[model samples]
Target: MKRRTRLVSIVLAAVMLLLSACNINMGESKEPAKGTDSGPKTEVGAQKVVFWHAMGGATTKVVDQLVANFNASQDKVQVEAVYQGTYDDLLSKLKASMGTNEGPSVVQMYEIGSRFMIDSKLITPMQEFIDADQWDVSQLEPNISGYYTFENQLYSMPFNSSNPILYYNKDLFKDAGLDPESPPRTFEELKIAADTISKKGKAVGANFAIYGWFMEQLFANQGAEYVNNGNGRDDLATESLVNTEAGVKVLTWWKDLIDSKAANNLGRKTDDSKKAFSAGQVAMILDSTAALKGLVDSADGKFEVGTGFLPKPEGAGEGGVIVGGASLWMMNSRPEAEQKAAWEFIKFLTSPSEQAYWHINTGYFPITTKAYEEESVKENLKKFPQFQTAIDQLHQTKLVKATQGAVMGVFPEARQIVEGAIEEVLNNKKSPQQALDDAAKEITAKIQDYNRTVK
Candidate 1:
């Protein structure tokens, strides 16, 4: 018995030593990421590239189809597509794999993660490949390309881009005696419409989820900045502007809907609000353009859906929605051959035919203007005219500082802080001004921490 106990202790000590050497804890596993796949039997000597993405649900099928098509189209490269859970989860795994061979050759990151990805020095800028290949970037949509461009260079290739828009039930609008053809365009107008709809008792006026992305969009819609220093374009941001007048106005208006019984406090899960809207429990809701197809299909026979621009405060000017989707980034840690192969896949994915297929199957806007000329996209537009609103909004937007959106290394954390602040206001725990001020202080500290390390 003594010898057995001693043997067990020896094994435990050896395990601890191994863990320390690997820089991992017992609580963590070195397993392959979820949804990882070994590429379909590749041709001999084919370059193998691994792609990490956060897309799930039916979208995974589309990604797989695209990969299959790419693989079949060429014999030089075979790519394996992996789903790495949420954006936060994928980023965590990448951080863990830093300086190791476990990192992917290509990864999809959300738009707000641009600053962090750039600062990490882990990505090969898309501009490098574009210059090497002499590709014509002029074919891309200006508004979409402009979002990923910084310091006069494109960092990543835009994919699955979208922005928030107002969705309402046309049938409910008629029942409330509101104009079904014209959805509300301003905060005051939206409020009145909501009240009228609620008074009829058919449904609540609106149920905008307490999402920080929406708050950021609202600020941009009012030509307001979420952060200073040219929205972190000209220089690294050192302060947050969440407590500005525009911020206060947004929270006040959002809270007023609940207070006046025109809208419900549905918490922060957008899916919950989306489900309610589809069920006719709510007359209006704000959601990503990417959700348009799902929402319309869900409401097929139940109700007629209508789309409108994101509402802003009265007298606000020269503002528009920021691009609200993810982009494909090539990693510098990959081998030259693998990186080149990944670039080819990126180009193929953004081609007119693929972009049109993506745009029609999913509700995301195509990043390239030429995709609109594709027969599939034209037929899709005819089938669902609501989609044209998103396209028109993107083109009409003035590419200014506010509409360009903010960039910060700590954006993901800052968004969570802002969401918490919104909760405080909605729950009557803090006034909008006070909640925003507190949230701003928290976000500023995080930005300072991130800046220190990057600098």
Candidate 2:
């Protein structure tokens, strides 16, 4: 009990630290773009729709532009886009505003929140809108949308989808006498490459941020379940599979790199590790496809950036990545007219042209396959082919429970626990197996607590 209490305290501290750095003013709204016209005057009696989103930094600008375009393209709906802080903050605020007018007509939530959103019964599933309009969901990328679909029903509209890929410094690989074209495909090969690079004095061989999301992706890539009961897809999960053989192998490989001095322990912030890679401090790193643009730009004139599939253990089979990103969900408590207006805005934001602009500006996938056909998308792809790796990896992923991803009401806390376990292993405070065993047990208890309350 003392150990569990300590873990919870650590997790809460981590959450507070992250929230302090990321949370923003809830009243923030986008400024109108300069040199852009508002297209047409809004129709009198236009339905007002409020949209709450968690987009931050430059991506927030793109989201604002998308909303601006949507409002200008039509006169019947006046949609107001508001920045609602980080994903954690947004969800918490939504809960606080339940049954109140302060809540939004539509909200963008992180992917892991699906189970909680569904169980809350506060959302109007996107499936209903699709069915009402006879909308063709087949147009969207199935692998990307697969994560939001539960019980054969899509609970939300996929947006800004991404997955992890291996980013390496080609110049470092060349300096280490390795082929720049062929990246390490398996765990053993990656370790060897890292050692070679370190031994050659080119750069630290690698540094994977101790991110829990990466842990989940690694488990899926090995066809391993992060939790039991079919990765929480078939039913509510009763246990975690974090201590499975696949989990141990992955952690062992990660620790091997650090132990041999081939990889540096850059801690939990992925951005710090990314900076290390861009500054030539590391030869390789694992990051989201959404970082492609920034990475390529940062490495400009320094080194050629190379991207590869997320490496797996030797002989692992039939595994692939789960989509990672946020999705749009409609609020059921809103009036029918507001709900319909929000649906129009959703469709407009996901249109081919908008998605192309989004794809080029942000490294997120277009979600709609047709977005690839846009001229801007084609030109962007031609300019930076590394982006193709993310798309290809997504398309190649097999749609299954493991890849579909685990769902749970307590996912946010569970992630912190898993990350803590990883930290314990990397710090040599606990063996990999022991750390995972503890995390799985702790998470299962949290799940049980959550299950009891929700029931």
Candidate 3:
């Protein structure tokens, strides 16, 4: 096999100059592109680049616009975008495509897929391209970028960035005799508020996705690393530290939510809990910032949507939320021309105008700082005031390896083991301490297994 060492560079001045062409018309004259054509694209000849992603429906609409904008702006690159199902499905297909030589030139990689992608050795770091071109990355969000940085280098281009935030129903709050404007900011306050809602019977107090993602958020919020070796940013992780003081406290607190009937326990299925929020079955919920648009559409004007940052543990301060969502990874083992063209398309996608357009259409956090100042973003924020909650969460986050999350090769597997423990606690089958201890052992073995293979 041959190694492709060539990487493309971008001129910041020229990229800024291209901003005018990237200006997204709130309503473009041409009909917006659909699934697959989203931020990922495909086309025939003329330096074709096939983009595979895991976005559909509403998200797809915005992706189409981005791809259309990029393809229309240049003649040398004809990009074809395809929707490849959920992130898991995309990862599976991507892994399977390794031997096919006909794989996509670019792919949308979920943040959790970071280690697997790097281990697969099929990707070319976005840093290489930036360094090759001497492009300034000052515009990228630092905390968000931290999630992808490993061994002092960025591994992918952050895209569709999001983080967990508290979503509450204003109508339910008012009905429960609570102030809709003042949401809970700490665990004690959250319990009080939920207790009020539960007793008032306006709605089920709240619902939680019985998953490890929020656990990771809670750990980060209190400045606790999910894995050893500085959460794998300093070096490869060797074990799971998810049974720490912060982790145990979070587990106990979440279990208390169910025990007190303050939170609906919907197993490990996030979508089921999401539907519960949209159906107005719960007064409050914790979910991703990217869910705002779908949630608004689902509520259908039945009630006012409200947002707030995730509640923190007592005595925790200045801690922060980690960035979720996916990023763009340029695959290697291809022609240098295609690699350059892919980088070109990626540069356009991350530009200010495109980011603002993406933010308005998809409720994703804009990667470019200047995107917030763009007219389109301003107008969208005015129209959807609730969005300010997510923006604030993004701005307030401090860069820490804990917030950036674990970077181990078995991170996905680690998440599953932790989620299983959560299931045990919620179902009254095990105590938080016991469940967490058991999960830690299993995850440790998995990590050790991986390290042995890699070594």
Which has the better lDDT: candidate 1, or candidate 3? 1
- Local accuracy of candidate 3 as per-residue lDDT tens digits, 1-455: 12332222245556666876897444332322333232322333357777899988878878888999998998888778899999889988988888665678899988988987888878899899999988778889888888988877888999989999898988889998899999899998888888889888767888889778899999999988988998877777888898888888998988898899887787778788888888888988888888888887788769888898888888985688999989999888555677788999999998999999988888889998989889989988888888898878877888877787787788778888888999998899998999999999999898889888877
Number of backbone collisions per candidate: 0, 0, 14
Worst 10 residues of 1 by lDDT: 32-41
lDDT values for all models:
0.92, 0.90, 0.84
Q: Residues 1-455, candidate 1, lDDT per residue (tens digit)? A: 99999999999999889988997644432433434432322445577888999988999899888899999998888899999999999989888988987889999999999998999998999999999999999988888888899988999999979999999999999999999999999999999999999999999999999899999999999999889999999999999999999999999999999999999989999999999999999999999999999999999999999999999999986799999899999998777777888999999999999999889888899998899999999999999999989988898899888888999999999999999999999999999999999999999999999999988
| Candidate 2: residue 379 Cα off by (Å) | 0.2
Top model number, lDDT: 1
Question: Per-residue lDDT of 1-455 in model 2, one digit per residue for the tens?
Answer: 99999999999999888877996434433322433322211344566788899999998999889988887887888888899899999999999999875688899999989889998999999999999999999998999889999888888999878999999999999999999999998999999999999999868999999999999999999888888899998889888888899889989999999999999998999999999999999999999999998999999999999999999999996899999999999998777777888899998877899999888998899988899999989999999999889888898999988999999999999999999999999999999999999999999999999889889
What's the lDDT for residue 301 in model 1?
Answer: 93
lDDT assessment of candidate 3: 0.84
Instruction: Name the TM-score of candidate 2.
Output: 0.90
Name the better of 2 and 3 by lDDT: 2
Indicate the TM-score of model 3: 0.88
Clashing pairs in 1: none
